[model samples]
Target: MDDFDMLGAPQGSAGNGIGADEDPAAAFLAQQESEIAGIENDEGFSILDSGEVPSSLIQDPDDANSRKQEVEWKEKAKLELEEWHTRQNEQLEKTKVNNRAAEEAMVSELDENSPGTEWERVARLCDFNPKSSKQAKDVSRMRSVLISLKQAPLVR
Candidate 1:
């Protein structure tokens, strides 16, 4: 028999030789065969029929949750960094206050001939020199002021 004969409709009434009211098994097989033929003719069958599960099916493909978590973590980290910087600034301010107090104490110990003379000495030690003769005059004037203040009578 021809190849078509094997797949031909049941033998009695139709143009294709298959009859109406065919056996359920035969009908099922024919339906399956037709589906196979349709797939063979379709160009996209290979792509559509790939056996692998799509990534979208396995997990939530949208990154909304992950992105939100990242933003939250960044905000938390930023807050922590800001707090650390604030603490560092406070410590720097405290150090500045202490340094100022020490400088005042050292200046007070100098002889009355020059009040800020010790500051000038410190500046010289650090390799900086007064810019002009006027600066030296200012220093002497400041010294006189400090001496006069020291000599003033104390009041309760």
Candidate 2:
């Protein structure tokens, strides 16, 4: 009995009967082809090219546009921030100028109030209105004179 008959298959029936080879590798290949053919004939079965991308993997046009818009928004925001910082610096400079002017004005007023004569300053310190009173009769002037002589009034 042939080897094929011992396996309960007729000779050359182990693979496709069309020029089938006795080699096991060829038989496996033929079996695979037949199985694939059967699958293709079944309902809702189709073969696809391995090189082609699936629909889910393809990039959508709307997604690309949204990404571009996001980049533009970030750029706009950065520009606005820079402009705001520039305006703030300008305002700070103006404030500094105003403050410096006010300080100078105060210094000038203090200089104007300071007496040109030391005697007049001493009279003011002794509570006499040097600019409004008669110098000869002023009691503060006498006190100023005594202080200048190092004989300041004794406090009792």
Reference-based lDDT, each prediction: 0.68, 0.69
- State the weakest 10-residue window (summed lDDT) of model 2: 115-124
lDDT of 2 at 127: 51
lDDT of 2 by residue, 44-140 (tens): 4233466556554566768989999999999999999999999999999999999999999877755765434444444445653456666566576
Q: Candidate 1: what lDDT?
A: 0.68
> Model 2, stretches more than 4 Å misplaced?
1-54, 114-156
Best by TM-score: 2
What global local distance difference test value does model 2 have? 0.69
Which of the numbered candidates is closest to the native, going by highest lDDT?
Answer: 2
* lDDT digits (tens) for residues 122-150 of candidate 1: 43344223445653444655555545544
